[model samples]
Target: MRRVTAIVPALLAALMLVVVPAVNARADLLGGKMTLRDENKMGHDFDQILRAQQNMVGDTYITDYVAEVVARVVTGKRPMPFHVKSAVIANPLINAFAIPGGYIYIFTGLIQSVDTESQLAGVIAHELAHVSQRHVVSRIEKQKKVTLLSTAGMLAGLLLGIAAGGGNAAQAGQALVIGSQGAATAAMLHYSQDDEREADHVGLNSLVAAGYNPEGMPQTFEIMLKNKWYDNSSSMPSYLSTHPGTAERITYLNDRIARMPKEFLERKDDNTRLKRVQALIRSRMSPANTALAYWDDMKQSDYTPMDWVGRGITLERLKRLDEAQTAFEKALSLAKDDPLVVREAGIFYFKSGQADRALGLLQKASIMNKDDAMALFYLARLQAEAKQYGEAARNMRKVNELVPEDWEVHHHLGMILGESGDVFGGNLHLAYAAVYSMRLDKAREYLKRANELAQTQEQKDQVRELEDAIQARAQIGK
Candidate 1:
């Protein structure tokens, strides 16, 4: 096919390499650039491996939230790579992992249990340390000597379990455990305690250097210590289960905090951000819980814009739309021209079927902050629904350019193009739309030409399934 052929073989070859470790002569860990032999061994690219694994784990919201806060704290100070993707898994364990690249995943349970953002920062910083120090690759190298075949076997086993709904495995070839995928994840947890401690120590310094409160380290450790005692298991909470001992580490952190300058102990943020995060969580809670948290924030006697925003969100979620509107408007009144407040109101209006109102508010907010891609995208969605097709397409195109990987936008654009009657161009976009959607029939239709498309076997398999399903649906229609 008239695909990007020059790079396609290497791309396809890369996909095959990482599909499973058995294809490889050596399971070379990620660190430097991939060698041809290493490439041959895995049969797929390492990047694909990481991406597949991330998709397997799903949302890691706590990680994202913590990373956002830390990013704010360390902004302009550290030369950390711009994190391209972040996710928070729904898992309630205390574990966090970062791939060789900038992908970081944090478990929700970890956030629910943490006492402070700094503590969370410590965890994130530690994971960032892993990425920065190339420790994941280092561990991979260390594992190679311990027994490569068994390691690959174990990793493979664990991954199979995860894929089949068995559990989490840190590495590729571990012995497969039956039942919950938790077992495999628990296995990876074993090697990283010392690494975790080192990360905590180093991460604390990183946090302080970045001007976050270093006291968050020891304070969080203390909370973990209490949880440790409260737990009946020999293993620490799932967070610490993978990491090494925390008691000595807590003491060490306390000693460091005691001896260090008093400034680190007294650090704080706008608090609005933290409270907003808390509020966001509360807003998603059950109605009873939402009411409780909202009242807790209000009755606390310490009022803040975030509290108002939080209560508004909870009320909105509770379907008390008018009350929600009032709360958000009050927040706006308190803080005139706040983009966050305006954005929230715009979202409420948009979701409430008031497309014009939502568009008006969002457009004004975007003008106030022209770089708000989300605001622009939402406005575009409303416009599209309202049959303002040309405007919607333009906005969609803009957002697509800004966030090329967002498949939904591409899909929308493709549908618009198809309906607009530029059949060939539309088909080309539709092919991309199918690939992004992992739709088989559409991919097959688009890939009918002898194109050297670089798709992993799994992706190819998904396309085939989609094609079959599409055919079945069409038959039913006929």
Candidate 2:
């Protein structure tokens, strides 16, 4: 599937080596306390694994919003061992995890599950605190002689529905042991009681410092604790099990919240941004009919402009075109300036063959939200259909810049470049499209064709870069 960018979902095709890492990489590691440089390499390699294996949400709107929250928490804090970055996993398991490299993965399930932005920030702050304290590093250093399951393995065990063997590191089936353990990892690296308590303590301070309500921390904990039993999924237990003293944690958190100043505890969360992003995730990521029903069941009083957009998207997915059009129109009537509503509605009209309307709206939407890769994408395609290949290529290049690794974007860009008569550029992009899409044979073929077509040094350089990428990607068990 295309990455669910704004409205499109892109699958990373096992860029998710984060969970079960490569055996060779595992062997390369020294069994001692890791230096900051070693930790950096470990995080980089594992990040590739995570990206490669998991279906990531590439929507700039959703991801950027979360990253901002992470930034808010980490900013002005103690200097970290590594730079902090964030990614969204496409799973519906109400989970988050941070690897050694300050890499935090937030699950769509957790986003969907949160009641407010504060609650989400609360959870994120806790994860950040783990990195700040270097808990993972300390644990590993202290336990080198133990036969216990590695913290990562324990997390993988919980995340992948494997057994969490206390001392049985032997059950870690694969040498690379990382993939499905996202939540377990986020119990902040399978922490001890002291570590867990410290995370809560440090995280709450950061959460309030970031201008969020103190209660959000305990509320999220309450949600997680309850969810442990409500979710029947075998994989979810690993997420909850790692946080052994949830009741005590919640009690302490609530006690802490009670002691905080009333102003901090009672702060309001606008939730407008959160709601809009949630609407997108619900409508785009859920089953078509299910999503439609979810929107349909909402009371009229609770409906926002984005809720209508959600309804429209789900309706469109179900091929209920007339109703979807009405829903979109209703959303536009309510909030015409909302970029999400405008962009989604514009795409709907484009798909419905209302080219003139789509052209105006998408053109406006792209300008309104320049970071929206998908809007630029459809704009390019719409312009291409009008035989305005120049406009198409220009807009498509913007899309390419916004989503450099998206194969579909590259494919369309390649097509537009070809149509615009830039054969070398076109073929180079096609080679890239093939490389990202994991079609090695096609990648090699396009590289050869592009190499033959290269007439400039820059063109030759592009070919060489893509060739190198293909060679690396072709490595077995990577």
Candidate 3:
């Protein structure tokens, strides 16, 4: 487990040194005239490390919602060299960033902190601008004296620091990379002041062109600034430290927004989906007590069906089954047609041992939104419990397609297929689940079994392909 964890970062570093074209006898600091392929390869490697080590939120609903926002941001924009992908990290820190290529990561805390969808879009646009502008590559090119080990160490340390709460851990990370060329390495990771300003300018333009309120840019900065004071910690937020001068940024963004046409500033994007996404994050990602308290506070004044849904979820997580059931019933009564509300009610019923009620509600939810992977997952599990192997396998297969990287989905699918006498399919999915879960040895074992069970040349070839991938990944560190 730890070996895979330790290997990928070093592998990424090695790739960067060997793949980057040398500029001169004195190494190029920034990116050494790296090609699009180099940037993408670096980003891809970093992304793997993140998926393996970070607490990524795998809920399909949440991911789909964020992807929709990304789509809107990139619409009509200049085509990126690499395909853009967004991921939500399950951390309660108000931060967002773009890795080299077009990979954007938003913390759950940032989503939870924003007042509206446009504000979130503003932050995303800023990160997207970083990738579009190739700031990471530029910064890497500037650090002429930094070694591959130091570069990798800095990237690993910074990411780990951000994941570990962006305080002491981040500072420790800086210290760890503070070798002979500490200043240069630090400069490489944190963009120059000019880069931040440029990103803000470019990002604001993209946000407005995408039809979002320009004010969202400043509003997001204000939120980050206010959070700085709210935290009152010995260390500032990683967002603040990494992207410095929040106050100045907020002021200028507001000035720029003011200078824009009144009509452009007033332009609105529908925030209904944004609110729903926030509710999901709060109910699912936040602590049970925290979510409970938040929903209780909201309902104390005026409550919507969504608020009731949130309360029910928090209550269920707290094991207050009776109260949770009542809350879900109320939510369902208030919004019988709402798929999310229905899904929550179904989950509540399932946990309370009312499989029939769970199945009915979940089935209804699936009809309402065939893409609701969570509902389908639960429905499949209930069917499996009732020994409806064929129906369960079908539903699980759909879910596996919907969330291919989800370890739990693959694990369940593997179990269902194995029970249904599809040994080859079962082992293949089990191998995938093991690989995603960083259990490389288990993955190899499953792949070997799958190879033995292959019924056709195509199946054998597929197994061999997977085996090669596993071998390559295993050798990454070495």
Q: At residue 50, what lDDT does model 2 achieve?
A: 46
Report each candidate's C-alpha RMSD, comma-separated, in the order given: 10.3, 6.0, 5.0
Whichever of 1 and 2 has more lDDT, that candidate is 2
Please give the lDDT score at residue 367 for candidate 1. 76
After best superposition, candidate 2 residue 34: deviation in angstroms? 1.9
lDDT of 2 by residue, 134-221 (tens): 7766654453332223544433443332222122332343223333333332232345788789989999998888788888888888
Scored by lDDT, model 1 comes in at 0.53
Once fitted onto the true fold, the runs of candidate 2 whose alpha carbons sit more than 4 angstroms away are: 1-32, 139-189, 234-238, 437-442, 471-478
TM-score of each: 0.67, 0.82, 0.87
* Deviation of model 1 at 228, angstroms: 6.6
Residue clash pairs of candidate 3: 29-140, 29-141, 29-142, 29-143, 29-144, 30-140, 30-141, 30-142, 31-141
List runs of model 1 lying over 4 Å from the truth. Answer: 1-95, 107-117, 145-188, 224-237, 285-293, 300-303, 419-478
Q: By TM-score, is 2 or 3 better?
A: 3
Clashes of each: 43, 28, 9
Task: Please write out the lDDT profile of model 3 over residues 1-478, one tens digit for every residue.
Answer: 0111111121122222222211111344434576777677666666665575666776677888999898889873567666899988776667777877788887777888888888999989998988888877766665545354433444455455444544566556545545423465434545567888999998988888888888888888888777787654421245765676778888899888878888997777787877887887788767789788888776444778878888888888788988988888888988999998898789789878999899999999999999988889999989988989899999988988887777778889889889889899899989988887667999999998998899899898889887876775553322
* Residue 298 C-alpha lDDT in model 2: 83
